[model samples]
Target: MAEHAEAEHEEEAEPRPKRAPIDWRRGREQAFSILASIVRWVGLIFAALLVLHVIFVIGSANSANGIVSFVRGWADGLSLGFKDLFTPSDAKLRVLVNYGIAAIFWLIVSGILARIIRRIGGVVSS
Candidate 1:
């Protein structure tokens, strides 16, 4: 009887499973991915707006149209300092100089920002 009781007690004391180690490098990578995606989305939005502005300028989109008005307003706000970087006498060249330059500028700036964000995330996760 004493042997049986000891055997039952030993059986009940099952060993616990070991926990999997956390992969912090993977976590950092995930963080960087999410940040990059957000930055890319923002960059795309700005690019689209600039493109629209270029169309509006080139096509002479009617300001009376709500969509045209809205796009122009947004582009005006976004271009800000970039609006008159080059005052080309020709209308087509002026549009390209203003909206095209702003678009390029936004793309470069957003890429730099994404890099910075990824580095910060990596440092924090590590």
Candidate 2:
């Protein structure tokens, strides 16, 4: 009876299964996800900067101020030539429309690029 019990205990002590090797395809998918997130965040930041600049202009913030100047410089560069796309008689309205359109453009372009990247990653995984 004792020998039978010992044999049963030994049988129950089987080794755990070995872990599988890391999958490079999964790593590629993760890399693509990270890239997409970065693109999305960059676009969001650009849009935010443009909107902030618009707010500063409409609120008549001092152009000579350091913060205003910095934001203005960045916003101008990110405007993609849309800064002066319209020539409304009212300066405020012009900024509103042009910068607004530029902001929307960034958002849309980023979203599309992110989606495409994710799709490519999915295809590679499959």
User: For model 2, what is the C-alpha lDDT against the true structure?
Assistant: 0.93
Assess candidate 1 and give its TM-score to the true structure. 0.75
TM-score of each: 0.75, 0.83
lDDT of 1 by residue, 1-105 (tens): 999999999988988789999998888889787988799789879878988989887888787999998888888888868888899899878877888889888
**Which stretches of candidate 1 lie above 4 Å from their native place?**
1-21, 123-126
Which pairs of residues collide in model 2? none
lDDT of 2 at 22: 93
Where does model 2 exceed 4 Å of error? 1-19
Q: How many backbone clashes does candidate 1 have?
A: 0
Candidate 1 Cα deviation (angstroms), residue 102: 0.4
Query: For model 2, how does the per-residue alpha-carbon lDDT over 9-117 read when each residue is reduced to its tens digit?
Result: 9988988799999999999999999998899999999999999999999999999999999989999999998988999999999999999899999999999999998
